[model samples]
Target: MNPSDAYLAHMDAIVREKVRSIESARAPEQEHYLGQAELWQRVADHVERYRDELSFIVRDLHANPELAFEETRSAEVLATTLERQGFVVKRGAHSLPTALRAEWQSVDFDPRRHRTIAVLAEYDALPGIGHACGHNIIAAAGVGGFLGAAGIGSGKIVFLGTPAEEGHTGKEYMIRAGMLDDIDAAVMVHPFNYDLSAHTWIGRRTLKVVFKGIAAHASMQPYMGRNALDAANLVYQGIGLLRQQMPPSDRIHAVIDEGGHRASIIPERAEMSIYVRSLYVDTLMDLSTRIDDILTGAALMAGVEVERSWDTHPMSLPVRNNTTLADRWAQTQAARGREVLPFGVLPDSQAASTDFGNVSQLVPGIHPTIKVAPPGVALHTKEFADYAATDAAVTAAIDAAVGLGQVIVDTLCDDHLMNKARSEFENAGGPIRATDLR
Candidate 1:
């Protein structure tokens, strides 16, 4: 067999062995609070009764995919669905044209006296691969969670539809607009290859480097012009070399946006976009400084003026998972017959960045993953996108919604758990403005 085929076979064998080991391992017995078990059961029953509706929403979103910041149709459909279900819906929330908000509160509950939780929904699809991220599932599950838990408990539940999570940090914008100021906790689930109680989501920042130079005829007066393309090339190479010295958890990638026109003419201006990611906010800032130095050195060597801009959109912070909340979710998912692995069981290299990280920093939260596709299926691929529409994905969505709803109910009814979550958030240094991280 060829080398590629051999490598694939070897990796598949390893994956199968790992799965067998995981399945054979004993499941941990989690502690549960006796906080209105009847209400929690009602939430689960609500999700079960509304399962077909939730599945239809996911399928509809999958059939019609929209990209970041332009998810008008998705937003409309979600808002309308919530409104029809008797939720007070608000479109264009937080000054975002495509963002949505729906609120519901039990009759005996007062927001001033009790805890409040938010269930976040992200409906934006990737540029070319539509629904590859399984945002459709996220949106439907979020709606189901809000509907299932709204009247079952005493506290207020907010269903937030955040747009543009693919590249733009819509939650960051909403945070700045005071969307999450009154929230106490947040919860959301993402579709993945494996079920996880909690997973690491790293921080990410974007940089745009523009180089300016004089243009002249390449063959005649090469000496009279400084090539901006040369600066871009130097910067790209410097970043590549810097990768060797970077930490294993850090990542840097770049793409040239403007590299000038004709070959006969010396390039006058060039621009390149680069993304830097790290597992911690402090590490991300340190890496940003290194990238800045490299860009400056590249400009100096090419004899060109360089301009650097960071985070044209809001940067994503690393997520902080509240163990108390995660435990509640784990118990709920266990009741549904899914065994969720703890954090360290999966390879940290599989982590990705999300706008929800910004919200998590502001509130105690749990962003769990529900298994939709089989093992070895990575997200944002056409294969994953196709699987997102299958019956398995729809079923996973219903289960995730039930879990999220039950967790919300638990958080609201169990005062001890809510207090523990708040204490954890406070001990973690609480919330900070995203722009102030640097």
Candidate 2:
């Protein structure tokens, strides 16, 4: 039988009550050192002036969606736009053909005294679900953000176009190729059902387990042959049992890719693909080890040889949001008449991972969510894809761009805020070696 919708209704009710309670309380004010009302007004005005152009970009991308690592047209549109705005554009940056790196600096820019901020853009679509994740909105917002910050400050701004965020880790690869080497901080926004200051994004690792056994005709010599499908079934059941012992913040899911072809023949080979997730990096690693043990046990019980391979793509780390930067984002959104809720105010039980998490671990960053759809609309769905093409999504994209631009302005001008952001990153274990995750 299918699951009941009662749980969904109950959770929705609980979230509504919690949101009301949180909104009633007054939020603490964030202090500004160098940024003023005029700077924010200027940025907003710049983004507002190009509203039509940004909307066109969003609609164009949504209309012509491209999958990960194949976003040639999408990348070309973004790159051409940035280049027209006087930004030096480089296609195929950091060894990725579809990636981009565009930069603009004020005349007084100095590496010694000023900071460099990156505004990241993602434009990759999912398989058979064009722009369901709203990456088209991301691409447009990032472009608008960079345009707003252009020629405004004495620091530099980079518009980075990252590709393939669906199942592959594009940011991680760019980082390995020196993408974040000179970047002081990074900021971006994602489209979601609600406006959030900091949403929960967990760590993820993919594993592929293969079982090998002798094949024989079941009716002729079934007892003489070992069944690899039996071992695969044992592993699947073992993982289901493991779920009960797992922590509430951890998640595991698996699928059998190969099994016996016919009942009369014992299968020679079988395989299963699994995804393991956890709220923390250490816990994610521990969970992977436990899962490996389960696979080994299943192989031993079924008398089959097992082969385990992990992370055909790069693993995504959990996001460590810098509090100082996130506070500035909240202040910006509030100025636009949107009350951005804090992290814990929303339910985090249903969470996903992002390549941005890896970017945050390497540099202090913020990946807030901007409201584009209703509360009941979830991401990566046909319904959400429909919403992504609407006029409301264009509005959210503009707001997100203004918010990110303001944050970049604040980080470049305010020494106190930058110092605090760096300190917060250090306190949370700064500059993780992504290669050491294994």
Poorly placed runs, candidate 2 (over 4 Å): 1-25, 28-31
Can you give the TM-score per candidate against the true fold? Answer: 0.91, 0.93
lDDT digits (tens) for residues 344-367 of candidate 1: 588878878998888888899999
RMSD of each: 6.8, 5.5
Choose the strongest candidate by TM-score. 2
Instruction: Give the C-alpha miss distance for residue 111 in model 1, angstroms.
Output: 3.1
Which residue ranges in model 1 land beyond 4 Å of their true spot? 1-31
In the predicted model 1, the residue pairs found to clash are none
lDDT of 2 by residue, 1-438 (tens): 222232233346446545643653356654565456778888999999879878988999999999999999999999888777667889999989999999988788899988899999999998888999999999999999999877787899989999999889899999999999999999999999999888889889999889999999899998889889999999889999988877666789999999978888999899999999876666677788889999999999989999999987899888877767887898899888897887667767868899898999989999999999999898999999999999999999999999999999888888888999999899777788658977
